[model samples]
Target: MRRREFVALTLPSVLVMFGFMLVPLYRTVEWSFERVSYGQAGTFVGLQNYLAALTEPRFGRAVVFTVGLTLVVTVVTICLGYLIATLVNGLGRMRPLVLGILLVSYVIPHVVGAVSFSWLFDSNFGGVANFLLGRLTGGDVLWFTDLWPNRLIIALNVIWSMLPFVMLMILAGLQGVSRETLEAAQIDGAGTLGRHWHVIIPSIRGVLGFAVLISTMDVLRTFDNLIPLAPQAVGLGNESIMLYIYNVAFREGAEDLGLGSAISVLTILIILVLLYPSIRSILKEAKEA
Candidate 1:
């Protein structure tokens, strides 16, 4: 391609990155170095904001929750998504119907799904979750109160909202598995479990790895779905990193844009650091393939 044509084709994307991403990122980093309030920038404070953020008690707690949530969500999403994909793949004629039903949760807007999930476990208002528990265990479970239960609810909501996407990805991967391989395994006296474990899973390793990567990144920045579920966790423990950042930026009269920007920069760094190994592995495999 000619240089002019190449430039013309790439100009729009370049402009978009500058306008939407680069400019905002630049401004945020600048703000991180200065004290800012009420839409006004103050004296430059060097690395004080970063220092304070690192030393914050809430920062430590949020880091713990963020790490814990990412691990749990990634595992559950992969295991359950693969299981559902396998079940749906076996349905043949019923695959579309089952997939459509599973995808309803994914299609709902994030805010609406979060609200719906939050209401389902509302203990005080006798939500459906509590009502079911009442009937079965003779006691309503307060899902939003304790740290463990609240974390569990958050994990469940994350899984519910993300399961469809993971399942769909795995289902697509499953399509690439050869029927002859499964038949060969069966002829060798392999049971259903053995066939899947030895043949089907190996055939879809790359796709499964991609799905796990996506789920990990998504869970790392999770916030909206957790807000209504963990409102009482303002600035304290139990909040994810994103939620903690949100609280810092818009906590009523205590808003600290500089500190928030600092946290945001740190969050981006943390995500890149965490995902670096997976990203490198994927790129290396692609290159070799």
Candidate 2:
């Protein structure tokens, strides 16, 4: 295609992205250096906003929770997703139905998922958690209110929302695995575990790495679901960095856009640091391939 034709095809999207995304991102970074309140911009604050965001005790706790959530969700989602994907991949004809059912949670809106799960697990209500725990332990398990249980609920919510995407990615990778290699491994006296450990997992490490990186990032920035799950205590015990940013940026009466923007910038840097290893592994594998 000619340059004009190419530009004609992509110009609208480019302009839209520039207007909606790049403009706001540029503004956010620029505003991060200012002491802004409401609609008024105060004097240039240098890195004071960033300093405040980093040093804030609540922000510190949120960072810890975000990291912990990311780690736990990453591991759980990868393990469960890979296992489910393997099972789905081996199915002869029911794969579509099974995969579709597995992805039902993903298809639902984040808010709906959050609300549904929250209500079902509400400690006061006669929901699933109360009923099951009532029967099992003859007592209610506090799905919310309690620190550890609330954190566990949030972690489970992230995993439930993320598992389908991870599974699909791994499933696609599994599709590319060499049947000949698996058969050869089996012929060489490798058991089911041995064949998978020696061949399948290695072959799909790139996909696994990518899946893990995506899931980790998603869990780190989880916000919408968290809102419905724990709206009152967003920047508290179990909230992520993004939640804390939201709380600061749009806190009830007065918004602190400057500090929020600074925190957001710091968040991007932290995520980059956290994901460095997985990203490096993926890039190295791509280079080798």
Candidate 3:
């Protein structure tokens, strides 16, 4: 392609990215170093917001909660997704129907799915899950208001929503596995577990790594689901990083824009750190290819 044609083809997307992403990112970074508010000029306050965010107890808890949730959700979803994908891949005629069923949660909007998911546990809504569990255990479980129970529900909701996408990715990877290699492994007396551990998983490492990266990033920015699912997040110490930022910057009576911006910057750094290994492996693979 000619340079002129290449530039013309890419110019529109480049401009859009600059206008939508870079502009907001620049403003956020600028605001992080100042005492800021909406629609008003900010006073310069270098490093003060950063220092305050670092020192805040709530911020510390939010970090711990968000990071822990990300780790747990990423691991669980990858394992479960791989297993489900393996089973689904073996199906002949029912694969489409099964996939459609699994994808219902993923296609629903996060807030709507969360509201529906919450009703399954909220006794006020005649929660079937809570009622069944109560009957089984002979006790009522508080899914909300309590710290651990609330966390469990939130994690479950996240896993439920994200599992489909991970499964689809792994299923796509499974399609590319070498049948000849599997046959050879079987001939070598490799059992089902041994074949998967030695042959299939290694073949799809890239797909699994990509799934983990995307899932980690999504879980780290968890906010919409929590809105309907974790109303008492602040009180229960279940506040995610994004929720904490929302409370500080945009919530009524807490317009600490600078602090929120600082936290956002810190969060981007944390995500980059968490994703470094996966990103490096991708780059290395691309270079080799």
Per-model root-mean-square deviation over C-alphas: 2.2, 2.9, 1.6
Candidate 2 local lDDT, residue 239: 73
Q: Which stretches of candidate 1 lie over 4 Å from their true place?
A: 123-125, 277-289
Candidate ranking under TM-score, highest first, comes to 3, 1, 2
Global CA lDDT of candidate 2, please? 0.85
**lDDT per residue (tens digit) for residues 122-150 in model 3:** 99999999999999999988899888999
> lDDT by residue for model 2 over 1-289, one digit each (tens)?
7999999999999999999999988888888999887677567989999889878888888888888888899999999998999899889889779988999999999879988889878755558777877889887666666777778788888888999999999999999999999999999999999988999999999899889888877888888888877754653477778888877888787588899999888877877897888678889999999
- Candidate 1 on 25-144: residue-level lDDT in tens? 999898899898866757799999999999998888888898898899889889998998888887978877887899999999766798889888886555888788788999656677
Each model's backbone clash number: 0, 0, 0
Stretches of candidate 3 exceeding 4 Å from the true structure: 275-289
The candidates, ranked best first by lDDT, are 3, 1, 2
- Taking all chains together, each candidate's TM-score versus the true structure is 0.92, 0.90, 0.96
- Runs in model 2 lying further than 4 Å from the true structure: 1-8, 232-236, 272-289
Candidate 2 at 45: error in angstroms? 1.4
